[model samples]
Target: MMIYTPKAGNAPNDAFLFNVKERSDRLMNYFLMVYFVLGLIFALFYGTWLIAVLVGSLSLIAYYSTKLALPNSTMYQYVLSAVFGIFMAQFIYQMHGMFEMHFFAFIGGVLLITYQKWRLQIPMVIVVILHHALFSYLQNSGMDKIYFSQLYNFDVRTFVIHVTLASVLFYICGLWAYQLKKYNELHLSQTLQMAELQKESLLLLQREQYNEERSTILESIGDAFFAVDKDWVVTYWNQMAEKILSKPKSQMLNSNFWDNFDNSTNSISYQKYKKAVETNQSVHFQDYYEPLDNWYDVSAYPSEKGLSVYFKDITERKRTELLLIESEKKYSDLFQLSPLPKWVFDVETLRFLDVNTAAIEHYGYTKEEFMGMTIRDIRPVEEVPKLEADLAKQLNKDELTKRSNFWHKKKNGELIEVDVQSRDLVYKSKKARLIIANDITEKQRYIKAIEEQNDRLREISWIQSHIVRAPLARILGLVPLIENPAESLDEKEKMLEYMLQSARDLDDVIKNITEKTTITQNFV
Candidate 1:
């Protein structure tokens, strides 16, 4: 911050005094020059070369002295006034007491009053009195040639009257000078006071403007704000605070805080406020308010004068948090109580994160053992590379679920085929997968057995359809020939023998069919 210091010349009454001194010095110099000229002219007329030189020298000295002494010397003006008085006296004496020249004495005395220094007039008055007394005595005491004035019979009465009149004029001039000096001093003092007051007023205006801007910023903020004095009276309540509280500032300011809010003494917000004030520290918390059916995030700051509070309505955020918690609970229940053998494993490390009861029982591993093992531990060594490739592909896809068949090893070292259905998920803030394993070992065995039985049954059906028909057709042809009436004895004997051979072939075909059926049954 910059500090303001009034200039030296700007000090009270000094400017006026300094200006007067400058003007007086210039005026006195001019008067001295004129007096010197007049004195020299008079001396020349009277043929007094020495007096002319003396007057010229005195004039030069007085002018230079006043010019140099001004501003620094207070007595310079009075000294100049005395010098002018002496000049007048010398001029009158040189002119043999010309009364007109005596009048110059009065003029010089009156002119010195312009300096506003009554003391200067005193020196000029003294010079005039002494000049009058001495010159008049000389003229009256056998020095009549030295005329003091136009009235040559220079009596004591005339001298007294002249001196008295001069004294009265000097007195009046001195009084006026004194009063003028006093007036100047008073005016300068008042001016200085007014200047000081103006400076103070300007400072006050700046302070007020600063405060107004601060208040504007506070009012424009998004958060609710209020302040209370030590007496618990509301001192400041901003627009946001008004909206949050559903009350206007006009109704809140200057009112007791507790009275207006009607909060219970045991309320969390009330307790927080009390704690902040008692400890002279800042307090922050979130709490639900029953009156407004809302949640608020509040902060209170305490100072010597009072406490300031800032708060925000967080009811919507609170409700969202509650809903999320409920959703998480439901998900946890589903994962834990599932009938399928379900487990979760970290995607990056492939370490088991969690396993359901079904997963533990189906895998034949304790929960603790499962937690300590990775997904690769449950897969056959030959299938690990396939599992890795599948996982690598899964990493590139955001698919919810993936299905694959793999050989899995149980805790008893038994290898079984499993159909694994897995989905991506985040568990405990880490990328992971949830898996449900369907054991297909028994079902696969049953399916293989049924396939073998179907193959055997198909072979038996082909045999019965082609081989049995060939044998039966031969037997039928031979028996018909043997039963015919037109046949001779040799032909009948040959036909009967052929019929017996055909019947034997049919019996052999029947035996083959029975053996195939027996084999088909054994396969089933």
Candidate 2:
């Protein structure tokens, strides 16, 4: 690429020239006032105040009129040159050709230098020479009224010397003015050239910084990255790419993108990348490389010159996904084949999402019937309100719910006791639960029978303690009477007979109690 570089030179937009021009403009506004004041001051002693006013007024009118008419032009500048010379003439005439008065014309030349233009001095120099030559001739020709010099003898050599000196002074001032203007333009050009250089340097610096940052990002990223040109040439290959692809930079860079690799199986990948550049679009997709048994997430971005493709190894992610899919399949098989009366239902609608074979058999519902039914369908009508209230309560998704003795109606309309426990789960992507219901009808019947046996055993225990005690006490009292030594034979025999009757009655009571105890034991 070609670049334009600027060099320092003296040019028109010079700072010094602007300042000089400003001084010149200010001098134009008021420099003539100096002549008028001088003229008035000299007029005080000479009695020529009318000549001073007349000449001063005429010069002012001409200078100001030309300045107004040609504001943007330099015509007023030339007029000032002529007008300042006229003031010098007035000074000489007022001084009556005093030799020192000629110096005023040189001062006029110096003042003109403020304009920064040597040409403004031309008319001033011409006017001064003309006024001197004409007045000198008139004074020497016996015109005593004309004052050309203080000495009566004004020779040609003297006049020539004075003219030469005045010319040298004006020339020096004009040359100085030209040099100042030249150097001012030179300084301006250098400043502009420096500015251009700085701009170019800044652009180069920014471009270099951007390249560094881009290199750092490409190398530091976790994924592999590489770039290819429009002709399928390798351009940039980051460190990650070298490592992941197991290729060195020397082997990959500047090499044909296809030639560097086995293209037999990767033609699909190559085509994908080419299409992106051809279409001028970016594409992102994953492709499996069969040779490496690897999967890559590819992102290709197209630019005017080429394509930048990034490759990420996603083989592990793909494998994990496959494992998860297999695991879900196994889980689904377990859900369908489990022997327990298990089911899954949606929590929001209380709808049955799935049912095991056991559930369909136990609940007496067909698979199609269960599919259309909500959890409320199997619940006893009376318990529906409780179910709603339970659901209405703010329930944590992680909470376990157990309805140990809830009633469920089978298809035959028989309400059976059930021990139901459920937990939250997501089934088929729905907010649902897997529930296990245990029928407890036989258990309740057994518990009731046990309670009845307990009641009968309690009555048997009462009979043994209160009624059996009477017979045992009578027998004990009679045995002591029969053993007494002081008893007569007849009395003893009567006591024995009474004891026998008591014993017989006691035996009957014992037998009756034994039969009832046997009955109670048989019942248990």
Candidate 3:
């Protein structure tokens, strides 16, 4: 999907100008061999194979020796190009100055173009010109071994034109080479630039990916989260943050943090956030924003570019916490103000955890004294074993409240009977008991007195039933006998006397019974 175009698309690389360059250096070896073979083929028809072989073999030996000596150098390419011109010259001589054979010089110049350096054509051009001028002069001066051209009418005027044309052709080839070299430089510059751009593009892609992942994580979190830069500009506001703070993302992001939430400028979170940036360190704290009427748990971290802040609305939690505090206060008041004696004790240690005012006064112990004493301290010594046994049993009991009777020893060592009411409860985070002590000493005493009085009444009722009944029966019998007199007037008089004695006896018994009844009532 990417296209790379050279800066100078019309022009080619200029390694052909110089000796073979970077990637083309090895190709020069093949080029050198081709040129030498051409020379030998020319020599075969000219009867100068010996000259061709000697020159060609010597050139190859020289180039290879230099290459082996200095492998890093490209100077060998130029040497080979110049030698190519010589090969062309030999071909011209073998053909006896054939004008068509002279085109080989230009061909050699063009072939050298692969190296992309214009300067590589210089040596070859010079060699061809010198060979032409020297051979032509010699042949014109009547030298038998030299060959210039087949044209016998070839004068100085024609010779000058001929050499001039060849020179121009070589210059043109070199010029093209120079232009190619410039194109290569531009192409290299462009290529390097493109590579650099690709590197930056890759880095940008990674940054965007990281931002996306961070945004996703922020959105997924449970806490209300928002972020601000060093300039206090809001950079991010998550869904939870918008819902909790009553500000949507569109209203928050990119806005100045202070300006958007201006009403909370006086909040502690604002000051702490600024402090975090100034110190260039992370800070964590909780703050109550008055305007929002909410609390926040915040953490701010400082970075080289800016500050990053994460915060959550803690309003609901704060509200619950305040309600819990109030509830505890209400219960504390109830416990302290209750009229009945009360105390709270730790179940595991049997130690008092708290005691009401009434408990303090009734138990004859100061609040401080009670706090230091355990439940065992307030019970009679004889009751301690029983108390332990009862507590052990209560450990497995799940009842909310229990009522029982116990004897408690006051601080002054006076013992009082009490009706104890206790319940299982959690107090100040500890499993404990809340107890109410209802004193019943006087009530028990009154109950015992009533039972004694009832016993006396039962005894009086028995006396009336058995003894007084006997006297009444005797009187009735004597009265009937006296009323039945016929020949018994005297007898009636005797019976009456007996009846009077019996009545006296009955009155005496009644008096005894009355006395006994009076004594019993007094006792009651």
Candidate 4:
């Protein structure tokens, strides 16, 4: 969520005019300084102290004016200042009689034209030419006596020398200005070109940054994103797209996506993307997958040149859905084929809602008949109270044990024993009991038979002890009776001893049987 703003905008002004102003300011300062020094030399040598003072005052004013006007002023202002400076220099050279006027005029004329004032030099040149011609004529016509009488006036040659020198300075300064102006224009042109190039570079950088930001945003998402041309060539591939598709941008870019990837064949993404490109319309589809059990929800949006696609992985969702479908099928099969009777009851109403096939057979009721019955309705009237108490206990407890039995009556009016297990568990988001019961009728009969057989065995043991012991007691008495005094005394004694031992053995057998019957009754 961070935003970066680039400092890439047009400059405040054009490059050309800025350079012109800068060059003009520099030239003006130089001219003012030269003018000041040359004016001082002239005043000292020619004794023209007042003229030097005037020149000094002008130079000072020009210096300050140049500084103040530099930012806003044009080349025309510097040309005017250079002209004034040339005049002062002319006055100085003229006092020496050197005749440097032509040279100075030529320089000034060239400079002025260079400063972009090519037209202004004509009038100044004509004035200087006329003054020089008149001075030569005056000297030729004997104006020398006038110079001696005129207190402040010079001779004809001196006037000619001064005018010529001033003209030369004018042309020289003009030429220099002209050259400088040309150079400045060229430099400004180069600078403007460079600025344009810089501007272009900045624009490119901004475009790159914008693309990078868009890429970062797209890649940061968990979904896969890509774009393709009408030709099915890959153009854009985001980071998530790379990871999900298992291909990098370098390998995928410009490649035919449909041809390169095996999953593309018959896949919803490929179909939608291709359709968008073919028809130039947006397309969306879900439940797309690779062979690896991965599912995707895909969308393709048509653009001017191609299509943009977004893909979301739904593999886990699809797997869960499949598992639920299989589970439902298994439950349905089990409901129809299960051997035990099972009933679904509503916790709130305690009414029977659904029953399996075995429940109908065991309960001797039709599916419709069972639908109208509740747990209380199915129980025998005599057992209703006990069943209610057991049900309440089951509701309070977490689980139900199968040992708790319910007496259910058949439609034939015969009561049957059923081992029932019921627990309070959530069914369809409501508290309900899943009751699974099995008919334990045959098992109860076998248990009763076993108990009767055990009783008969105990009766037989009692008879063996009492009835058989009576006969053995009689035989032992007979043995004592059979012992005769006519026989040896040892024989009579032995027979009596054997009778005592037989009676003791019979008593021990009776005690063992009685103890066993007591232990068996305690277990029961």
Off by over 4 Å in 4: 1-17, 20-24, 59-70, 75-82, 85-98, 101-225, 230-312, 317-524
- Which structure is stronger by lDDT: 1 or 2? 1
Candidate 3 has its poorest 10 consecutive residues by lDDT at 1-10
Local distance difference test values of all predictions, in order = 0.84, 0.82, 0.80, 0.68
User: Each model's TM-score, in the order given?
Assistant: 0.46, 0.45, 0.46, 0.35
Error of 2 at 333 (Å): 29
Residue 211 lDDT in candidate 2: 93
Model 2 residue 178 CA deviation in Å: 3.0
**Residue 348 miss distance in model 4 (angstroms):** 40
Candidate 1 lDDT by residue in tens digits, 130-243: 878887788777774575676757898988988899889888888888999999888878887898899999999999998899799889999999999999999999999989
For candidate 2, list the clashing residue pairs, or say none: 10-185, 10-186, 11-185
Models ranked on TM-score: 3, 1, 2, 4
| Model 2 stretches astray by more than 4 angstroms | 1-16, 27-30, 57-72, 141-148, 153-155, 183-210, 217-235, 238-251, 256-524
Model 3 Cα displacement at 462 (Å)? 6.9
Could you give candidate 2's per-residue lDDT for residues 85-194 as a string of tens digits?
89888877888877787788888888888777888889999998998899888887879668768878777998899889888998998998788777766777787789
lDDT of 3: 0.80
